[model samples]
Target: MADDLKFSAPPVMRSHPVNPTEPIDTLPELLNHLHQAAYVEMSTIPMYLYAAFSIETRGYSQWDPGVGASRLIRSIVVEEMLHLTLVRNLLVALGDGADVTFYDDKFMPKYPSTMLHRSPPLLLHLGKCTPDQVRDVFMEFERPKPDPLDPPPPDGWYATVGEFYRAIEDGLRRLDQTMGAKLWAGNQPDLQYVAAYWNRDGGGKPLLVHDLQSALDALKTIVEQGEGLEPGEPTVPVDPVHPKAGLDELPHYTKFQRIAEGIEGIGTLHDFRTDPHAGDYAADAGLTALNTLFNAAYSYVMHMLDVIFRTSWKDLKPGESNFRYHLERSFISAMQGILVTLAETMAAVPAGPTFEYYALPEQGKQAHLIELCDKAMTYFPQLGGDNSVRWLLAKLPDV
Candidate 1:
């Protein structure tokens, strides 16, 4: 029997954009930014999960036009949840408890009016605007074209939110440089607080962002580690907190393994863990590899903020060309990429006991959801030809 599914748009809300540059000198200011970022992360979790649930509700049996697309989206949703967790953890670490009891949607930042401008020749590339409305949202946060003569900023220095951290980093660097070795001895509360975690582990290995060289070296190390290449193959036994071990221990792996095993032709997803035939590249080093990719990506993001704000803070006014939108958009897109890849990879692999029953009736519904994803993709070009969303969508295998 054929199933008929109809498409409907998700709910939209209007609110003011959270301006992070509003001169936050007090703890309240920092807390506000932390809260706002956390809220955004929290809101995204549901959006991704709902997209995934829509697919799960519809069974895998029939060839609904967009079933594959929905499945990919479901994967993206899960990763978004992980990002939310990451941000929440960061907030808690900063002494801001998980208190969203008073968080109103109206308080959430709105899209900038400047972003809505139709005057300029909008460049729609990765993270740029496109035709599809759904896709447009994904592409809206792309980086602007850099001036040729100035030479683009370094990898960590971004033109947007990247500036914020850059400012903080600059202050630390200045203090260290001017005060000599005694800078670390200062009693300033905020400095002390940031210094406390300067060498802390972010789940796997300890991350040290005290200097530019250290930051660069960390990125290189993460990339290398993801490829399963440790320098010198030290005689040390595997530490429980090692990136590889930590990733392997994630709960999602069990589910991924199950899905991989159930697929038709692919063997157990675990096979990728040891198979020499698996691609020899760093990015393809399986789950650990994916973790490394995310970490590197995040490092770049952090670095960019450090540089941008360090250079621009003195001249810029509050709420004028704020980078919050760009930051949020970058996070959303990167997270989406991670989740979709994880799920799709798992589904593509084959291994375990196959279920005898399939949800035939849900196939039509799943297809309908996939179609919505496709329509969303079309909206990307309309948003100024930004291909970022399209790039994200392309990562999924053709539906």
Candidate 2:
């Protein structure tokens, strides 16, 4: 059982590698990607929390399909929290601040109806539902696709989340070749350093800056230099491609605009891959496969949240005032439920022969959770409501 699994405090920091010297021809585009990455990370927290709440309050004893799902979900949630922090730190390093304000209920990221094609009907109806109902809606949000290679349209782009990362990697390489030294000479210390790290790691070897041991050292450089921490440092020196040595740079776009662009780019990338006839713009090559992997992983996490939210809300009768306190509270509860479900799912991995068929190892599970968390946290602060309110809501009673 996942309950028997030990819980431990997550590491305070981790290393990420990037190439600082590489020049981005489209600084706005690159920044847009970063913003989208951050937004996804931020969006995941509420779902994880809701899952944890459902498994604990609703009682996992009722479900016999899996054992470690809840524990895995918990671990993933914590990691998602970590990812959010990491992305925020990166954004800060890049001279950006995420907006963490709540808006009207209508403002939530609308799950495209097309994305829910294969999803259970119970998971699809979340229009103005109660807190529990909202949580249930998320239960299917994170369910793994049986064949991630063939993702549904609108949402399924590339092949996996790993493929998405690959696109970022490719973009960084292009930026390096195109922008060169001009990219590194920027006053945006964080962006410069990240470029450097990306340049060094483009070859695919794990860079020192990305290793756990070197995280603090890299962070110190980022902080002292007023740059965001690069996940990894680049090994190769950047080539000077710009003819003009010290061009006065234009003032970059506002933080909000940067974020919006980043999110849009990600969406665009997804559209490119999922649309069979996207043609030249389609993510047929380069980092499209990585983007697909990223989407799959992201979808899996959301599916878990949907399950917990639906189950929990359905258990509660209609007309409950619990829905009126604060919509953010509901978001938090749903998040806890997601966490619990993750933990339980992971715990159950070793219990059946199905595990062999899937070939999902324990370490892979941890890494997947961590990756998902990192991806989701980037947009958490941009969410509505005070950080305290968000935190308190996440810590609410599971039921």
Candidate 3:
């Protein structure tokens, strides 16, 4: 039944809004909660990417982009992506197939927005990598729990994201006991995103969520990685040379805190416009074209992800051999090579990359992406050097 659903299905109407403090007794409520988790993970990526991209890298070595801050923030972005993938697989395993329709207005968060249902809301902004932004927004997103001596948050809100996931974990255990085998009947292990397909080095390997324990393991990764450590876990010394070195590596919150407190040097950063949008550059042809190409490549990455999760193993025909693997490789290439380089180029122009909601057209999507590249090249000739654009585009799936 999920297969019959459109790749870009209209957003699902939930029975209730995602309020983490409330009970998730029913299957639908749990599914909706997981969807919100996915959104939370997805929403943070662009915000973090914006800050990472805004760092000025003119004097920095190519190997070390934007000095330590940029590298640190980008590393965290990769983990957030890992978090997103984990949440998506959890949803798919629970039978609510992947919904990568990021183009929809409802799914994408507006600039200067508060996170979904968070209490005492903190406004999220997309801008340069400043100490204030790092402390106020980035660190706050993953702020550790209050001192146990302090009072808990109001009844309907969670103190931290870790508390929220713990609640989800409790709900999953309850539902598993109540529903038994039927709860996991919809799980399709083959459809999960596992380590074999992910080529990147940082951010722990993708965990395949099949059963209840595996599901909880995935959630643990999300919480622990986001908020520095688990309760009672000693703080690991920051590895300046290799921050994301291992499982005990410094958590995201710590990384940002270091930069915010000047414990870590971020160097100079460009003051690009906050909350940039594709429409913001309408008067500037070059920016508009570059933004268009960047967005197309960005959207195509999401499309490829959707295709990977929804596709079946049996569908790999002669021409489609290792299609999923190719998609995985291309997705990484697009992010690291195409999107990263382009965003930096835009930053050098004193413009920020706008992560707007743009979907590739239903048909000939790959060809359209190539066309966008050519159009963008007219303004940003740096994009086509060494035929990297076409090389990356050639691996893109048409779907």
What lDDT is obtained when candidate 2 is compared to the true structure? 0.30
Residue-level lDDT tens digits of model 2 in 158-277? 222323333444555576567665443322332111211111211111112322223233323212111111212211111112114442211111111222233211111101111111
User: Which runs of model 3 end up more than 4 angstroms from their true locations?
Assistant: 1-16, 19-21, 58-67, 98-103, 147-152, 196-201, 231-247, 317-320
TM-score of decoy 3? 0.87
lDDT of 1 at 183: 35
Quantify all predictions' global Cα lDDT against the true fold: 0.30, 0.30, 0.74
**lDDT, candidate 1, 189-222, per-residue tens:** 2211111111111123333233334333333332
Residue 20, model 1: lDDT of 34
Best by lDDT: 3
Q: How does residue 170 of candidate 2 score in lDDT?
A: 59
Clashes of 3: 0
TM-score, every prediction:
0.30, 0.33, 0.87
